[model samples]
Target: MGKLGLVKARHLVSRTGMGAEWATIQRYKNLTMNDAVAHTLSYVDYTLPRPPRTSSWTKTVGNRKSVSRQRNMMRMSKNEGAALQTWWANHMLTTKTPFLERMTLFWSNHFPSTIAGTKQPSALYHQNVMLRKNALGNYGNMLMAVSKDPAMLIYLDGYSNIKDDPNENFAREVLELFTMGGTVYYSENDIKNAARAFTGWSIDDRTGKFINRPEQHDTGVKTFMGKRGNFNGDDILKILLQHPRTAETIAEKMWKEFINTSRPNPGYTRKWAHIFRTSNYDIKTLLTAVLTSDVFWHPANMGGLIKSPVELAIGTMRTLPYRLRKNNLAHNLSLMGQSLFAQPSVKGWDGGESWISTQSLMRRSGLMTNLTRGNLRGKHDPLFMRHMPECSDEELMAWLIPVKPLHPLPTQPGRQRLVRALVLDPAYQVS
Candidate 1:
């Protein structure tokens, strides 16, 4: 494990927690771990200024349909669409906690949902709020909220589930994707039984409320994992949580996300899983333990991972010597397959290797060029050079990059010359 001074620590935190920034990272460099952790957590709730609206539909049942119609109309209007883009731009620029914001962004992709598919932006928005506000909170709470989430209800066909005719989509995903690993922990019968338990649990299309229609609920006894019960959705969840695989599977995913590998050490991951379950699914503790470990700060681990497209774009922009307008910034990201509220599918954007291809590489290189050369409108900052006075050219390269130190400046005159010639290099492209 690397025990870094403040300067290096800032770089590590920013890359791992948020995408990238120089000033805030340097500012936090001198602080103790406690202070630094608190400062990092503070940047989470940079909510955009919501426009005011006097909707009479929220007051009574009669106006509800009109309200929904109005919402749909606004969604279709070009002006409102432009404003939405503007809101995201401003939020990204001015948010207090870039670390938390980026973490929320990371989780959003990890558990992908699309307002375009669900036609429920409010539910998508609700899920965003839930994830952002509680990204580091209890995993159990997040799981439960996601289970009944309005966006999730529609995305996974939870709303279509009926008492006698249960939809297995949500239940299967909850087990196979969300909590447990593959079929190792659950059999086909368990999935079928779990599906029955979730019947009658749905969202109200008009109000976005989670409604449990007991009348439509399946009350049949279920034999799940060799145990019998008149299991409902909650019962299914409870049973899943109780399984050892649930804890281990989640620990594995968490390690992959933060530790930068899908194939993390299972023994070590299981140890962390025990820590997570023992602490009652406190995600923060799990994250802290992982981040502060020797495995995390090792030279081999540094920059060994690929940056997701969103990370590449955002990090490059933030590190640029310019000021990008919010609308344009958000627009640029949208074109690069990472629009804020619009993911492609329920599986979300595949990270790591899948995030790159011939088409995506062009988009990535183009974004870097646009940001660096002041090609973007109203976004040219000359102050970027001053952000890292302490970091020399070689140190700057190391600071911005999460990779092992390349040949130091004095050793490789030709490579140093090349680095000076190119504003963006292959190193910056790595994590």
Candidate 2:
């Protein structure tokens, strides 16, 4: 009920948004907890810069049909995909509503479609837009839209699905990964039937839009989850939405995303799932419940999550006056293991402890070191230092690091020196 002071404000911003930005934390520190949460959910910026030019689906398809041009097509796709990654990274670095972009990134992993898998950056660009449009709106709606998304259709082999020879890739992942969390709730037969139901959902070759070919559709009765009916792709999605586990799956993911990387408590997840399902899968409603829950604000949970590459790199840049020496942030992120458009697998990046492997830890530490190298020297830029918040040493430590510095602070008294020490400390690795 009281105002969320500096510590609490940082937790909310770092967990929900891209980073615990200084100005944002200062703004939130004065507001009541409820007001702060409301403000975070409400603020969103929809404007996007012009996307990088990529080959149209029609052109790409034409090229793919020719054996000699196939290699050229692959090269083109790789080049365009890298540009797409950079474009998105730039947006995340500068977005006014980092929370909106953060949620968009979350959903992207939940329903992944890779540049390599699709070979269509244009379609992936559209898919990213669709994800952001519904990021905070409705889970059920997003599910329906993404299921037919052209990038997903190609990535999951859904576009190749026809009545005569049904491709089960999309159905299998939808049941196992997207909705149910695993094979525990649905049967193999359910997946086969669900695949049959989704048969005719394909992409328009000329326009690259979702197009249902009724002639290719299987109009037979299918039993999905013990319910028998003549079904289509929409029907299958509607049935999944009605399943309780669909809501629970998202709730559990939110736990890992916002709380900590440990296994989620079912008691908490089930309660959140009920709220999600009852609200007709309203995303904001579920987010409000999760953000306001006791566990989200618990003292023991502070610094519980390991920072993803985006959080470490983009978050640091946003919070401080530092920038990467090289502008190839997208490539840097790939090296650090969170490439924007190219997830390693359908499971996406296994964040958490996985983000800090021996190789990745070195990269992470090296990044922080490089960003703070200039500041570490006594030759601090007076203009930049003056622009920084005027605060005591203790306050500065709290603002920069989520927890007490794992290593001792510097004996030297310069503000820049202290900041460099806090950032380089092991404790700065977590939120």
Candidate 3:
């Protein structure tokens, strides 16, 4: 393949997946950009398992009587909550539908919570399933679903909200991080009023399901974002979704994530924001446009982002063909400064230059060493095949990096040699 096909392939792969492995990079190598985009869109989350309409906790909560049951459930070796994290990591590594997994991960960051905080495996699993279901669907619907999500209610302390003592935690994050760009768009009064609107929006103690206690709901007129009514949680959600900055804020963040730029261009950001609003906040619509846009294909975009920990770990496994032990995943990722399900705070990972640090870099290198030698406890030892087909230096370099190698390796370089060198190289740190 020519340089253009390879460059375009890397651009698409980097923007859309955990890593730009050969299997993924090869699919787009010969196809036209339009066909390639269609290929990407074809791989939705429809085939992945759909979660039940309500989690078991939603069905069971009642009071302190069930506390012992909850504790015993957590003690079980076959905890579904712990299992959910492994399932996700394995799926992302093996997936051909990389965008579906990528978007799921993105939205998880956008609406972040830890299973540690939720304290219920079913709630965590169900919330992730809901996120996947609406990953590329309607943002408005997703926001509403999240508002009623038991896991979210627990994580943000929404479960404690009541008429007399409304919790502002969830309401504040809804405006500052989730909907509007930042505190600049909303006021202290707005947050307080929004909290009132969400009062009585809480999960049942025994069922672990969301229940709006009307008796606890503040039905008195409350002004929120300049709109006055006896607004409730859903009503305030609608208001935020319709706000002028909602689309713009999400578009800009999405741009930063996929485009690898510090900030979006003025004219293009405005145009994308309009497209976002006009689509009524359809996630797939905005994403598809960005993927197919000239902005995405710019030469400056390729391999520019420092790969996040998940991207590096999963991408390596996918590209290299390895079977990592489930137990080691979280520990390894956490050591590398990206815990699988436990983000340090609601702001998410603060990814960027923060991804690189002396300790983390050393840990990453150690990981590569373990991977290269099959030294890890996983069954997929001898990670690289001992023998491989001979190839020109150019082709091998292209597989490892999007660009032609400035310093070429020997023709027929040993497979392990190439694998080790590539992973340790500075280039491998970028997507």
Between prediction 2 and prediction 3, the one with superior TM-score is 2
All candidates: TM-score: 0.83, 0.98, 0.87
Per-residue lDDT tens digits of candidate 1, residues 130-154? 7877787877888887888776887
lDDT of each: 0.66, 0.91, 0.75
Give every collision pair in model 2: none
Off by over 4 Å in 3: 1-4, 47-81, 323-326, 374-391, 403-412
Model 1 lDDT-worst window of ten: 52-61
Ranking by TM-score: 2, 3, 1
Which pairs of residues collide in candidate 3?
A: 57-207, 60-206, 60-207, 61-206, 61-207, 62-206, 62-207
How would you order the candidates by lDDT, starting with the best?
Answer: 2, 3, 1
Quote model 1's TM-score.
0.83
RMSD of each: 4.9, 1.0, 4.2
The model with the greatest TM-score is 2
Model 3 lDDT, full chain set: 0.75
Name the TM-score of candidate 2: 0.98
Better of 1 and 3 by lDDT: 3
